[model samples]
Target: MTTTKFLTDEHLSGRVFDGGWTTVASVSDVTEPATGKAIGKVGMTDAAGIAGAAAAARKAQKGWAAAKPDDRAAVFPKAVAAGYEYWDEIVEWIMRESGSVRAKAEFELTLSLKAIQIAGAMPYEAQGLVLPSETGRTSLAKRRPLGVVGVIAPFNFPLYLAMRAVAPALAVGNAVVLKPDPRTTICGGFVIARLFELAGLPAGVLHVLAGRGDAGEALCSDDNIAMIQFTGSTNAGRMVGQNASKHLKKVSLELGGKNSLIILDDADMELALKNAAWGVYLHQGQICMSAGRVLVHKSIIEEFSARLAEKAKALPVGDPMSGTVALGPLINQQQLDHAKSVIEQSVAQGATLLAGGTTDGLFLAPTVLRDVTPAMSAYNEEVFGPVAVLVPFETDDEAVQLANDTEYGLSAAVVSKDVARAIALGERLNCGLLHINDQTVNDDVVNPFGGVGASGNGTSIGGPANWDLFTEWQWMTIKGTPPAYPF
Candidate 1:
């Protein structure tokens, strides 16, 4: 294992830490000797390790929940301080471990800092309310935090998405036990746990366990876990939510999305093509909200596809550390295989591959598909890879229909130079977030971010809504005035 300093204030230089890559399991390490790339091994955690963390959280949550909101907020400002201290190394390791290029990795670190700041400044919103009653005496509404939150994260955007739940889960006074993606385990939990310690948090307030899905499931099914915050595939999400239902616990799932990008006839042609290309290919398109389906106006379908093809062909592909490489490998061999299989099946069903669609090692080329239909699996299913299927539509109504065709409705986009047209399309698209003339405008802080249907419910973010997600509300009223209206 190799421990590195991701970030910390100068005073806590020795305090900040990340576990070196530890070999937890697997027959042999997946490696490409030619390029020196290592696909990580599967990892596990014993039942005792899980039970120990759960016990610590249950004990810590009791006092943390009773502590004032301001007391909780105090830890966050220091986390932000740590962000600035280790910004460079944070981005550097992100690029190396997750295979994300420098630009995207840098952006993720900056956004994480912003989220920490937003979560720390949420005390005013956490306080309960006193209400005026029609009867006579006092009426009150109280908000109570759930005890412990088990955060199970996926590999993509490892830090960015994990922190989304981490901030609010802790800010609302709940203890946290995080189970990071086995693929990106050490980067999220080990790195993040050290920062919490540097922020002056209690030892048991946050526990990092490096393990696979089974370890996480154990935590979720335990009687002590008050909530489960999950981000992953639709199939796994269903099982997680089902288990949490048995215990009647709260949950937040930011699952898969077959998100669409609608290019209206009025779009800024040059701008739309560039932005869409960036959104579909960045981080090898492992992002859930990444635009996988393109709805093009019939009037400009051919023209836009040609332009998109040219832009995609220009993206350089190589190792992430190369700095000049436009695209990087997927996290492991499994994802690379899945991306290839999806493309091959789509091609067999008559979709034409436009720019790039082939795999080498863990690298899948940026690809574009023409003449796609909703009946195809790629149309409705979330393809967490660098692939896009362009469908032509005669009008705005047809475009909206295509965008809403998927069971997953996490995000969507509208590209148009006309402000009114873009706004209209944004309003009509049934998604948690909408982008207008932009590839992606993902702000990870200060908002209630979540979706419906297979995407799951309960927002885990900073804002008034953030507080409500982690806590339940109950109303109280005096009985004196009730007799006045009694029948």
Candidate 2:
């Protein structure tokens, strides 16, 4: 077991605090995914506990919303400073609890910190707009915070994904009740709790409920929660959307993606290979925007596949905590098994396994497959692992068809030496995020990140988009005394 300052005995013993750390009757063991060993135990909040947290959040939200926007914004700078102060600890927890490599862990921390910094400015952004009015009355459209928000975050990129919503919601004066994935309770839940505590956020303003599906369901259905912000698999997202809809609550879902990296014949092979490898293998491909499909022009498919295979074979895979490795373990046995199954099924359907198809414990080697067709599972499904399936296309139309065929429309990229051509080609793909001469895996605090179709409900959240996602609009009109009434 590893010792920690953030996740202490009080936090682990299921004791509820006034800070929204509600009591838990039971606990679940937190395991180090790389070693499959119990590192600590986290309190498990059931449905009732979720309701308690939501009530607390609703109560706290009153004062939080009433405070001056600058005052609310003041807390975030302190939070950002605390994040820097505990940088090493945050990175360690992310790597340990989430089985992320050091690089990925560091990247997540950077993004998480950036999110807080960006959110600090959100309170000052224009919350309303003046509109053209008739009958000499001043008409104004204004935004108001949705009383309390429920954040259901995923295990992959846990901290950043959680904070991206949590920070912005709080900055805009809405209290947050976060339900982190049970697998990453510490990094996704408790860490944020500790940071805000250090930053002097008022009690009950931000609740951390480390829990399972029942808790999540409670969060969505709880009347006190006005909205739900979710990031996870598409299937789970559907359930969240359904539950939230039943209560007439707002929902912002950032779901699954089977993203593609399209390499045209005019692409620079060296750059394309780097983008392809990084896009598909970073964080072991646990990212929602990881490139699941590598579409190459038939003219360059042979060369691209051969080099990609070489790159995969050379990349290091091991326990991230033990050393500096390019890849880390799949989150658990199920992910490993799923990746293996995908590889086997794709091969059985005539996709050629070019490089890797082996595993040691939960660490699956970076795998590459060639000649993948739409008929194969690798092409149709979102393989959330370090496996890249290469498909050949003869024309630009075919490439667009291949990229847009998937139900997922989260992200897609085009790689070509001809930047103009790449942009034109990229514009044809049916995805929310499209990159030209770049990789599929990318995110920034300023960008409105989201997707369409199965990927999301056509809503985005980040930067200015946060205002819309976290608040509701109202139109108000002013008159000197009273307008002449029509009888």
Candidate 3:
């Protein structure tokens, strides 16, 4: 609404973003995040675009993969240099094109810059392993590139979500083709492509296909694509799974999560509010790993509930570009409506609204819900917007049970001053990334990421542990004289 130079269907550059001028940018008509109306028109990448890109990748991936791991690692610094040069400019565009608030966009850009740096020096992290003393078996197997990697990124955390694959996929010696979510294609993929290109990297090693859903479908199902990396809703994740399964291709999914937070009685009342609020309301609760359902210790439930309501009421809500804004607009109207309907439906089913359940002009107010039970649909779902449900628990055992009740086990947090209780509760919580005395979103660059079940498949995305997501171990055999196993 502010900057009238709309994006292009063909992703030309930051200056020339004219995506079909279709008002609603879409390859196959992308549904607006706010209105659910097709707000923009995008060009369709036919089968040939997929084929051509795949063909280009087939040629480049071999050479890229054959290069030493250290050589591949060098690309990161070059990328970082290019990225840092345009950090502020890109941050502004991330706000404009992706609708990210200034601070969140800066957070994303900064995190991505750090991720690139970490990856630059990660050739050591991608190490080969050897096994000995297994009866005539002295094996050393190294990670091999999955040839062409197809990355389908979601729009919510555009930079973070998209690069989650790019850094590792490239680090493990794979060529990549990134298909960005239609709504924020310009801010996400095109920007990355521009940066990588500016870094003086070889072309075709990484390509940006800027079309819509049809392009993604074509890319995911391509025979030439060795592996697929996806991050989005479970329904879309399921479709990607089905397509990959049809080809028996390897796929890594960071899908839907219904993360839960536990606030034990021993936790500092002040700390719990800050951490829970960060986990639930930050990014408008648009993160897949958002801690939407919280189980508070009954002893402190009354006090915790009051503080949470006040916090939600206090979070500044408005245009993301506005510096004073705490909560930005839900990616679009559809999300706002969906989030609103869930809270409304819960209220209809006897759930108590503690604070802030309102939406206007793409802004969904930070909401707090009490008297929530597992029976309500909102209790077990990924709201993908700012809505927190408070469910009080009688004991630690009951708290653990309540937290683990959901089908999703992506991430969870245990808040308590007792170190033993935090660790004990964290172990029993049953999720990918468990935080003790902290919010689920807190992490170091070296920690292993990902969740169990529908949260995510595989390990995680930081520090020394993140490389496992891009590799598979193979047991190599050597014959002394016709090797045979002794049972």
Top of the candidates by lDDT: 2
Mark the regions of model 3 whose C-alpha exceeds 4 Å error after superposition. Answer: 1-44, 68-71, 124-126, 133-139, 472-487
Every candidate's CA RMSD: 4.6, 2.0, 4.9
Clashes of each: 1, 0, 26
* lDDT string, candidate 3, 201-303, tens digits: 5667887666666777788788889888888888888788788768887887778888888888888899999988999987889887788788898889889
Question: Which portions of model 2 miss their true places by more than 4 Å?
Answer: 1-4, 14-23, 134-136
List, residue by residue over 367-447, the lDDT tens digit for candidate 1.
998888876767766778888778899988888888888777777888888878888877987788777777653665766
The numbered model that scores best in TM-score is 2
Which digits, one per residue and each the tens of the lDDT, describe model 2 over residues 1-487?
A: 2244655677766543448555567888989999988877878888988888899789989999999987899999999898888888889999999999999999999999999999998888888999998877899999999999999999999999999999999998899998888899889888899889989999999988877788888999999999999999999999999999999999999999999899999988899999999999999999999999999999988989999999999999998999989999899899889889999999999999999999999999999999998899999988899999999999989999899998899999998888888888888888999998889998988899999999999989897789889999999999887866897
What shift in Å separates residue 15 of candidate 2 from its native position after superposition? 5.0
lDDT of each: 0.75, 0.90, 0.75
Return whichever of 1 and 2 wins on TM-score. 2
- Model 1 worst lDDT run, 10 consecutive residues: 11-20
